[model samples]
Target: MEFELWYLLLVPVLFGAGWFSRSFDIKEKKSVADETQTLYKGLDLLLDNKKDQALNSLVNLAKIDPDTVELHFALGTLYRKRGDYDRAVKIHNHLYNRADLSKKERARALFSLGQDYLKAGLWDRAEDSFRKTADLESDYKVRAIKELVNIYESEKEWLKAIDEAHILEKVTGETYPSRISHLYCELTLQCMFFKKFDEAAHYLQQAIHADPNNKRALIMQGTMLQKQGKLDEAVEVWKQVGKISPEYETLVVASVADTLLKAGKDADAVRYLESVAEKGINSDSVDAAVDWICKIEGPENALEFLRRYLSQKKSLIGFKRLTDLRLAQDPDNKELKELSDFLKNQIDKTVRYKCNKCGFVTKSFQWQCPGCRNWDSFAPVRSEDPSRI
Candidate 1:
């Protein structure tokens, strides 16, 4: 019995001795071989979609050799990509809580945890995780600030959003002037809604300072001035909008006209509106001009001006206005009635707005494109009568 067992052991021992020369150690080679085999088996299980088995193997390996930070990270990231967020969270959380982890490894784990929380829509948890990561001062600082900014915006915490946006601008060296202006504008609107006029005014000034060409701020400022019974000042402020962003004249037109009328300068208002119309902006400008003309010059002169303008330039809003005007007068005029009906149908057939970013056309104007989810991407453009484009 002893001789038989010795022969069995001798067979394996001789094979091992032959592979390990006199100068090399046999134990070190066997350890490496065992590690390689374990890794291959774990990878094969994972490839075969046996995630639970692969995880068990990795956990056992981790218990035996706690230094496999790379393997742990790979497994954690794979779990995240596979939508096993809870398991991913557990793995990353374990790594992050390890006192022996290197600073870089800890930061990576914390970032991964934050991303997992974000994916889970636990904004508060994600924010807390990211705040700790901020202390690590990793290269992910800018990315963390950007994520925090998004979180704050989503939560409607405008103050926090403003702070984060400033930090991101400093870190990334990329200007966010328009976005900063929008943040201030959001705060301003919030304040105004609560009748905190002083706070609203301060925020509006900050918004204009952040983006001098912010038409929304100009419009709000003009409205505030008009509400305070400073019609002249309001009109002057509204006029500034046209100088700064000629394309947004339509946005401030109604406000400017009302303020001018209140200030007893209807003629001056009419002149400005007509000037913008002559520049061939959106048809809304022509419609605004027509409104002023009807108010200041009587129906006959307004009709004649509109007819002459329509003969020179074509637009849906202009046509709509002309149709309404014609139908309002001489109701028995069959030719004018027929023309109004035709123009109304044509106007109804055209899309009124388009996304500048993706060229998505829609009938309603949206500040954000529903398709691409970009802010201020929608612009009013002339919709060709199918035959025209």
Candidate 2:
């Protein structure tokens, strides 16, 4: 019984040696009591709203009792929460450099230091600190990795961003297809700017592999082919965008038609535009398509096509288009032409593309919402009056 009791008592003593006072003596016991009293006083000061005094007391306690790792962390956290990143970094750096800290405590201190650096806009130092904080068993491992990923993204290190994106997906079991795909698209942009068509195509393919439904990747691929003077191939590649995201047709239609025209496929372009209209089109896109038709097939043919379409489905937009076309054909009629121009301007002001994610309105289509950074968040069909020019 004596041995068992001594063993039980010995465990806490050993734990305390690691956790608090390292020596089991009268001097160390008194030191522990003094430290405890100081901590209590600091808490009292904090409760009384004497923030500076409380922090000073806590700092003194940390200096006297280097074993009080948790106290240092709390102080650093308080500093960081109060936006005093310099002070937080100093406290965490002190704790981080201590030789006696447990691995988890060290990780915590390092993470705190990284956060200080991050908040201070010290990206390079923050990356280094976060890297040190990464431990498989530590609670901050995933968070550190994610911070590193965000750093890579902010720095535009697309390849490193892609690597972390994979790690994050595996660790969280949530695929970041769009994010991964976009990173590849960014790479493709760089390669294209350098006139490395093959390299750009490879990145576009990687993007497609990452997310088959990534319309931007497809769009980039088409752009790459067009850059290579493969107009037919470019048009074919761009047509895939409509299949992947039908709502994005408005964005891709002009490119596809232009590509078809360059490839001597004017009839194909007209048929493609007609097929697009068959599905549905906003007033602006339809008007733009009619402009294309007037240029390619002739204004008379464009007018007849618009008349037939408006007969089946009438909208204010189509009506406005009809009046404009009629007025253009009879430009000598000054009063009628003036009325058409007035109505067209009114329609232009009222019809707008709006971001469904953030309600940001623009006159032009945005593949990614500028306000919210969300892709395909703008409704395809809703052309409400724009909030901007």
Most TM-score-accurate candidate: 1
User: Candidates' TM-scores?
Assistant: 0.73, 0.67
Residue 280, candidate 1: alpha-carbon lDDT: 55
Pairs that collide in candidate 2 are 350-385
* Weakest lDDT window of 10 consecutive positions for candidate 2: 380-389
Task: Report the error of model 2 at residue 159, Å.
Answer: 1.2
Off by over 4 Å in 1: 1-13, 19-84, 98-102, 298-300, 303-313, 330-352, 355-376, 380-389
Tell me the lDDT of candidate 2.
0.80
lDDT of 2 at 39: 94
Candidate 2's residue-wise lDDT over 59-135, tens digit each?
88988886667887889887887789888999899988898888888888888899999999999999998887764
> lDDT (0-100) at residue 323 of candidate 1?
75
Cα-based lDDT for every prediction: 0.79, 0.80
